[model samples]
Target chain A: MLTIENLHAQVEGKQILNGIDLDVKAGEVHAIMGPNGSGKSTLSSVIAGHQDYEVTKGNMLFQGEDLAKLSPEERAHKGIFLSFQYPVEIPGVSVTNFIKTSINASRKAKGMEDMTANLMLKKIREKSSLLEIDSRFLSRSLNEGFSGGEKKRNEIFQMAMLEPKLSILDETDSGLDIDALKIVANGVNKLRSNDNAIIVITHYQRLLEYIVPDFVHVIFDGKTVKSGTKDLAIELEEKGYDWIKEMV
Target chain B: MEFKEKLLDSHLAFEERIDLSDAIHQTRLESLKTFEQKGFPSRKDEAWKYTSLNAMVLKDYALFPQTETTIQLKKVKKYFLYEIDTYKVVFIDGVYSPFLSDTTHDGLDVCLMSAALSKAKYRSLIDTYFNKIINKEDSLTALNTAYAQEGAYVYIPKSVVAEKPIEIIHFSTGKEKALWLQPRNLIVVDQNAQVQILERHQSLKEHVVVTNSVTEIYAHQDAFVDYYKIQNDLSTASLIDNTYISQEKKSNVRVHTFSLGGKLTRNNLNFCLNGQHCHSTLKGVTLLEDQQHVDHYTLVDHASPKCESHQDYKGVFSEGSKGVFNGKIHVDQLAQKTNAFQQNNNILLDDKATVNTKPQLEIFADDVKCSHGCTVGQMDEDALFYMRSRGIPKKEAKALMTYAFANNVLESVELPILKKRINKLIAKKLGVNLGFDL
Candidate 1:
């Protein structure tokens, strides 16, 4: 569903992602583990078409279509979703309003009518309960004055609402408690399907214990150094990324 | 042969052609003499430091004659009363047209100031408050009071709250080379009465026209009044508005000014909280494009104890437009426990667009809570990126963000229909449609 060939990206003329190649097919869960400066987050941001990152060289293809030419919004319309590391807080805009706008925009791009308010409320209620998000949270401004756990859960709630083809969770478990981590992981596990792909990027294997990945890859210095099965995650968890750094 | 000499020569020539009324002719002459003595305000004047009226004084604007002309009422209805049902009073070229007015509300009195001056009951009311709150030191106020030949006087009696809003539409239309219009209005709300007044000022002609308008509002004890001023003049037209509001005990007063179109526009709004527990809210939105310039100066005075005032003003400058916001809040020594807050925010879109925002707070009582802040900046890049990342185009994203910014003021309006109209105006100003339902 997604392919990257020797992708090189930079921000302010400083190279971040150099010669990164990765591929993911449908119905698979992939975990990319790396040290602090291994370009794990940069790779996700570049694929999501963040304008701040300049793609210096190489090409990224999503479903056989070149993704470099598309804007961030266009990439979103192509069913690419990025769960940000730090969710933005937009004051005076309710969560329901923001989510409705996004869903309507995506639906419009897919040649579908906007969901009615009644239907949307019903769907939101159902998904919110499943994700353990309080109904009152929907009335508050989008992520404004929200705690770290609430913001992460809101991101997962949004993922459920958009139902994108490829979901990239970037540091989703960084500031979450164990309870929140389990809740977020349960939401992700429930969302997995045969027609969709998931990419979980994290530093520790704690989150991996809940949402088990089928494959794990060690990233070093902007390049994928090793690829293995789920057992590789446990091995890296026991022996930190320094061991992988020396191997690279 | 100098620039000032040539400009004064042209001004005198235009001044010679103005024919004043018998009642105000003497006053007009004296005022013009005063204007000549004072001349146009320069940077030497404390209040005129930021706003220079030199350009206006240079252009000799011709005075519009008092004549009855057929106005396209349909266009007025389309723009001002598209969605609401209310009593409408229309004035064309500063002359009241009884044929164009619709006054059908119960216990409501709307009459021309000229006619009201003749009645025994309203004469004293008109004479007592006519230009009373406007400062004589203001050259523009003196100019409007001296030149105003006709105006409207509206009074809502005690214990009577009108069900519908009263709409006052002033249109400037003439075939003359240049036209000068002075419109005056005085609205009084008796004790415990409620009213909403909307004043729409517009000009249809492409020629240069100058509009000097003044509106005075008095809210008695326990009265509630909401006033909205919309200025969408022609490209060559200029406007100067002075609005004075006085509130009594436990009364609530709100004034919203939306400056959308004009070559040069200046609005001064002043509110006096004279009675205890009185509340005043002043909110404004100004959007200027091209080479347009808009200036807004607002003052809130807390005279009595426990009075409160809040002000929020926002401006958007694009292209080569310029905007100025000067807001001041004054808390008297006797007005302890008073809470006054003021903020002026601006967004400059283009490189050449400019904004000058100054928020002033004067507190004579140390026990009062008063805060004032002003910010001049570009749009939030992070917010813009976030919206755009959600599949909204850049233009749409900008419009949404701007709308959100202005909505902070719009949400405070109590009337739904009026709020919706103002929302639509803001949306149009931001180059977007009013598709979102609040």
Candidate 2:
């Protein structure tokens, strides 16, 4: 469903991703793991069309569409979602309104009318229940004073609402407790389908234990240095990243 | 001659026309003298440093309109808060339009300022409350006071609650080439009385009209007053609104000013808490684009002990628009245990759009809590990107952000219909229909 060849990207004057190649078919979960500043988040941002990162070389294709030519919103309209590592705090926008707008926006881009209020509300109720979110939580300002766990949960709830074809979870477990992490993972597991794909990007193998990936790619420095199965994640968990640095 | 000189030269003719009693006539004469001495404020003045009236005052405007222009009720119905029944005092081209007005005198008075000044029944209320709290030294207030005639006069009797809100609307018909207007309003809410008032200055057609309006509100013991000012007019029009409120023991007064239009707008909102346990709430939302400019100068005087004041103002500017906010809070020595808070936040959508905001606090009391903060910035890029990545286009995302930034201020609006109207107006100002009722 998605393909990248020798993808090279940079932000400002420095290169973040260089000579990286990846391929994922439908129904596959790909895990991208690296230490801090290993271009893990940069790769997600590059794919999501963040204007700051300039793709200097190579090409990315999603469903045969040139991904680099699309804006962030266009990428979203094409069923690409990025669960931010750090969600922004918008003080006056309610969660329900934000999600409604997001859904209607994509619908409008697809030349469709707005979703009926009743249908939208029904979908919101179903998704919020699936994510174990309180109804009151949907009415409050989006992430204004939300706890760390609540922010991540809200992101997952949005992903559930959008039902994107490809979901990028960048460090979704960093700020969650064990119970919240389990709940979040359960919600993600329920959203998985045979036609959709998710790229779980993390530094540790803890999240892999819950949402086990079919493929694991270790990115070192600015390139993907190794590709393996889930066993590699357990191996790296025990040995740490020193061995990967030695190989590089 | 300059506009100031024209105003000074025309006062004699203006005085000859009004039914001026001795006391009121003397006050006007004194105010005219003050205006003549000070003329218009200059950039050198500390309070006027950021805003200059030189461009506006350079050209001459007609002191009085040439004709008695009348507008049909249906033609200007949209300007009124007609969704709900309101007692309206409407004016056209500086002259009262009796056919367009719905004045009342049953138990409470919601009529004209001319009647209050000339008629014997309302003379005592006028004498006691009119011009009582205005800053006589200020040139613009003095100018409005000098030409004060024919505006709204609302008197709520003691312990009486006005059954309906009052709307004071001044509509300029563009009859003259360039017109200048001075409207004086007197509102006296007696002890335990409650009232809500909405005021606006609108230009019916494209014309150069400048309205210098002064309003004095007296909130007696236990009284509650809500005042809303709408400064959305044509680009050729301008408004200088000077509103003063004096609150007694346990009185609550709140003022909300929405500045969305006009070429040059300046708002001077002053509050004086005269007794203990008084509460003052002041909030505003300003949205400007093009070459428009708006300045807000606010002062809250805490004269008695145990008083509280809350002020919040938010502004959004795009293009070459400009904005200014100078908020000052003064706590007297005897006014202990006072809590005064002021906040001003602005977003500049364009690099050329500028805002100068300052918060000043003068506290003489030892045991008081007073805090003020001001911020001027552009929209958060990360927030913008986050919204865009959620599939909202850049323009719609910006509109939503600006709307959300100003939505909190509207939450305190007690009138639901008016809030909805302002909601539509803000969305229209941002040029987006977010597909849902905010």
* Per-candidate TM-score against the hidden true structure: 0.92, 0.99
Per-candidate Cα lDDT values, in order, are 0.81, 0.93
User: Which pairs in model 1 have colliding backbones?
Assistant: none
Question: Chain A TM-score of each model, in the order shown?
Answer: 0.98, 0.99
* lDDT digits (tens) for residues A107-126 of candidate 1: 77789988988999888998
lDDT of 2 by residue, B96-208 (tens): 99999999999999998888777887767777888999997799999888888878999999999998889999999888889989999999999999999999999988999
Weakest 10 consecutive residues, lDDT, candidate 1 chain B? B2-11
Expressed as tens digits, the lDDT of each residue in B1-438 for candidate 1 is: 432344334444544544432333455556655655565568798776677777776665555554668765675566566576777777877777776787643576876666665556665676666666766677766666655546777889899988878888877775656776778788889999999888887777687777778888989999999888887667788888888888999999988888878998888888988999998989888878998989888888899999888888888889999898888888898999999999888999889999988887888988888888888999887777676666666776787777777767778877787777777776777776534644
Instruction: Give the Å error, residue B399, model 2.
Output: 1.0
lDDT of 1: 0.81
> What interface-residue Cα RMSD does candidate 2 give after superposition?
0.8
